[model samples]
Target: MRELSVGEAARRAGVAVSALHFYERKGLIQSLRTSGNQRRYASDVLRRIAVIRVAQRVGIPLEAVRRAFSTLPDERTPSREEWAKMSAAWQDELEDRINQLMNLKEKLTECIGCGCLSLTACALANPGDALAADGGGPRRWTPG
Candidate 1:
């Protein structure tokens, strides 16, 4: 099977070698060593790097990403079925986050019409906006 050196892998992944090393250190990817004592990675590592970057963009920490990857079999490359399942899980999480953000937007939009009284009841409200002087920030008035 084809393998990539650390530099080659990083170049193909469009990231710096140091970043690749960091990812390996963080358990986001794995590498094997050649007889010459140099790092080598399976060519499929490109896909893993892509997944790691996408997970990070979606606000998943490296630890969480590692844990998610741990659920997959490590004997061989992940099959299409495994990829589909993982992608589905991530999609569900993204959908839930989107729903939450939309809910917040709806609440803020409501505040514009409700005389901003709900601002006191809303936890996401900007604490410094007109309520800081009165100590109505999150510290003093916990959201319900």
Candidate 2:
């Protein structure tokens, strides 16, 4: 079987050598050593690296990626079926996060109708638009 040198793998992977070393250290990817004790990788490594990059882009944690990889046989590049299963799992997580973000955005908008304290609608603090509540005018701070 043909193998790629570490440099070749990194170049094809579009990551730095240090990143490859880091991935190896984190068990996200693997490499074999030559007789002279140099790192080499199988062609499948490019696919694995692509998965890792996509996972990261979508905010999936490295630990999560490692766990997913561990579920695979020999931790090799996932087959198409395996990828579909994995992507479905990530899709659920992304949907949940997107919901949370949308909720936060709504809260932020509510809070800032006239500058409430971020996500907090503290009644004791500067609650939403005091002047707007009474009448359309400006409110002043006495500086306590």
lDDT per residue for candidate 1 within 1-144, as digits (tens), equals 788999999998888999988988987788889889899998768888887887767666777777888887665888889988988888876785577557667766777766766555653465544334334533421211
Best by TM-score: 1
lDDT of each: 0.75, 0.72
Q: Least accurate stretch of 10 residues (summed lDDT) in model 1?
A: 135-144
What TM-score against the true fold does each predicted structure earn? 0.75, 0.69
Report how far residue 134 has shifted in candidate 2, in Å: 36
* Winning model by lDDT: 1
lDDT of 2 at 124: 28
True-structure lDDT of candidate 2: 0.72
lDDT of 2 by residue, 31-98 (tens): 88999999988877887788788777766678778888777767455688987887787687668557
The superposed Cα distance between candidate 2 and the true structure at residue 138, in angstroms, equals 34
Would you give me the overall lDDT of model 1? 0.75
